[model samples]
Target: MSYRGPNVVATSNADEKTPAASRDNRTRSATTDFLDPLTETEGLDLVGILSSVDETAYVWDLTTGRLDWESNAAEILGFDDTRKVATGAAFHALIAPEHLNSRLEVFSRSVGADRVRGVPYRLQYRLRPCGQRSETEIRVEDQGRWWPGADGHAVRARGVIRIMHEEYLEQQRQLVRNDFDELTGQLNRVRLTDALGAVLTRAEREYQPCAFLMISVNNLAVINETFGIEIGDQIIAEVGRRIRSKQRGGDVIGRYSSNKFGLVMLGCGPGALRVAAERFIKAVRETTIKTSFAQMTATISLGGVIIPDQAKSVHEAVNFALRALDIAKSKRFDCFVAHEQLPPAEGARLRNKSIAEGVIAALDDHRMRLVLQPMVSTKTGKPEIYEALLRMERPDGSLVSAGEFVPIAEQLGLSRLIDRRTLELTVDLLKRHHELTLSVNVSGLTCSDAEWLTTLRRLTAGNPDVLRRMIVEITETVALEELDQSVNFVDTLNELGCRVAIDDFGAGYTSFKNLKRLNVDMVKIDGAFVKNLADDTSDQIFVKTMIDLANSFGMETVAEWVGDERSARFLKDAGITYMQGYYYGMPFDSSDYVKAA
Candidate 1:
């Protein structure tokens, strides 16, 4: 018997002219004899068993590249003739190009491994039958073991190949589901962003133009409230469909958020971006959407940023587009706004970027330090407690005050780190100095930061003295913004034995009811009203009223920004418990203050 194919020599089984050929023939004979018992069993249906599982067993002669398969190999592999898969080279030719390398790599890596018992391998790949195109390709899972020859190379492999057409189809469907939005049948946000990054790279390399637009359906919330959420969803789906229809072949669109869609337009310049945005807005606006409950007219607002011109990176592209979209919405319904870099905003962005880098570096380099500002007792003219102020030292040793970086840190979501560090330093100081009473400010963001609270709990745990002497100060505006969360935060601090003070109080003109609800231990008068208390009658009345109300609630009042003897005397006469300002003393380095004390 002889086998013939492309890249394969017609070899006679009886010839065995070479040692490798002789070994291959012997291996084949041994494999066939091993399966002969199964075929001879009268009651056991071997072919039926293999067919039931859509599997075909094979013994591969690696040295001769010859392949021997079970009787059902051709039927299971969807080949018209068994000769099509008679050798490894022919079988490799049938493997889909995309998966060919993977199949080869698996076997290559298996070579030289422990082959006494054989090296086991399993892989999945697609195979195209002879005369069949890729659309009709069959997916098969091939799992087997191979034995190495004396040369430490794979010489023989015996394995089972199971057709996985159904599983392959399911996997393809799952991939589609993962890469596409269910409602819009468009690329999902993750895939769309990936595509955006790819296009941006191409644009930058080719020096072409691209634009990313953020289109928001203008009254989605109102529609949801007036009709129903189901109707709102219908509107969103319809809008997505309309936007997709208007997109160019090369353009990509995705549901970016609930009411917003992101469109990435290729080779589009500033002029083209505006035109595309208007076209998309018109597509959704000109036609009314028919929903389950009612027919509604939905208008969309568009904001876009041209790539490499107005935005350089994916993050900048998304943010700038959203910013333009906000401006468009503010102007009117069915509006289009293209992002133009404003000097001040650009400067601020650059400043923030620098600050963010500096902040992270400072934290890593242990350059963050605390300065103590004394809040003095107005009656005794003595420091009662010190407020811990955050300061970052530059590489040059110049200190950056909290006023410069704290707001930016909060905006950049770096406040939590700073807040945690502050807590640790404050607790440390309190533990070291038995006479020290310190106040540390907590950002509004930290109130919701469970990790920060956990850190606080861990540091002050079982240290009642430290907790009692520490005051957790929260600004009045922050407290009033989220009254319930603020109340809860204060309650937790109180429970932990830490005193809670409403800092910059009277700044928000906090209602008496809300103030009482806070249940705080003290209120720090807003400095704006206290600094000119002696000269400004209105400041005096506001301060006096705040003091009276705070006193009535049994809450102590600490006047801030008191800069003169008259203001300090007036605060003392007005029942102020403490006063803090330049008039009392400037902020001292915590270490220096500790040494001096």
Candidate 2:
């Protein structure tokens, strides 16, 4: 066994009282199989194998002021001889400057006189290759322990050092790829959400205004169909590049989806964010993008909303931006839309968000209740079918109306829950009152939603009589939008003995051809026209035309929002068979309905 080097230090003052002979004996015993390069025993041979690989075995003899390094250490440090790399400071020099101190601390703990026996020493850090910038650093994994003399003073430190540059770089690349979108080289959805969450938290803490912009390339599908997907991809890439170029220094930008980019701007209020959104829209619209087969200018729509002011979370902010973006796309091209502040009566996006959250919580807690508004037969002047409406019981003991939360629920995709709940409640109500009939409003989405369809099948199949008493009222807009699905749905309902009614009938431009094909049982005149039927001759004519059309198609007509006696009388004289509004009776909850009965 031998130890050879000039870089190690002798045990310091703490070990000065130990006899020289005793220290020599301890050093000899500790260096035995560890220093014997040819030792073939299990642990001894393990060191030899490690040294043969890309790892180096090193030993610092504290008592002799020497350092011994194996051949691998010299090779890794780009030296032909061990001496060139064996100096005490040479290893420290190879470490990146930022890591040098930490590396030294680990070493100090392992070899320091005060360090107790069995204290572990392990460190992983980057090493700057000679003549290269710090950016091109390599990783080194070090593990070793300090051994003490019989007198209890540390005299030697030995360990294995592995060059892990390639492995570490591969790991880093994999991590980056996971966090970023490959095509656009921008943060992907998951990573973008995490980044936004962090920014939101920080902004809240600092009381700074932050904003989010949802930028979408308009009609990307049309481009793909016309020019090919390759050209569409090129356009998307170019748009990402332009967004990156225009984004401010501290702003965070990411590819939120295939054709959408998300931008988080710090210190931006509503006005500043609107200006930024305008610039972004102009930048993309003005830039000419060249692809392999085509060159064209692309238009973008941007929706921006101030954080904490417009929304409190990434989910809410993104939703608000998306809503604004939808409005922009529908209203104008190559334009920016900022979430607007509206009068309290209008119930802006934030209010909708609050309502949505409350609706979700209420649904989770089974706090939603059904109220029925009676629809009276104009000819008989008697209540026949009661329209089931949704109401939510808030935590504050206040009740929210159907008009307030129904639209918000649909917007948040929570209408499916409301529909299912309403169906269940209506079925229970019908079971209790055999002669009672109820018209339930269902989202057009339910016709195609697999879960809702399955649920409907189950509920109706249980009792065919319940189906006979149910009239499913679907909105005219939805019926027209999902014409094919709505037609099939109405047919299915009719086969189940349930009648179907088209709601808000006058709002949409559904043609008579499509109307006859739907085979619905009734048309509920939209409140917009019926509300002013008493005074407005145009509304009067519109309502009369709807009734005549319904009668011609063998479908009954129900006038909605018949709030005044004049409106009801006008609707009745105009041949409306049923009327629904405060003129009949305001919507009443089940408890009130039971008491009234």
Count clashing residue pairs per candidate: 0, 4
**On a 0 to 100 scale, what is the lDDT of residue 217 in model 1?**
91
Tell me, by lDDT, which candidate is best. 1
Clashing residue pairs in candidate 1, if any? none
**TM-score of model 2 (CA atoms):** 0.43
lDDT of each: 0.84, 0.78
Q: Candidate 1 lDDT, tens digit per residue, 308-365?
A: 7777888788888998999999985579988988799886997798899999999999
Error of 2 at 290 (Å): 72
Candidate 2 wrong stretches, greater than 4 Å: 1-353
lDDT of 2: 0.78
TM-score of each: 0.44, 0.43
Give the lDDT of residue 326 in candidate 2.
Answer: 86
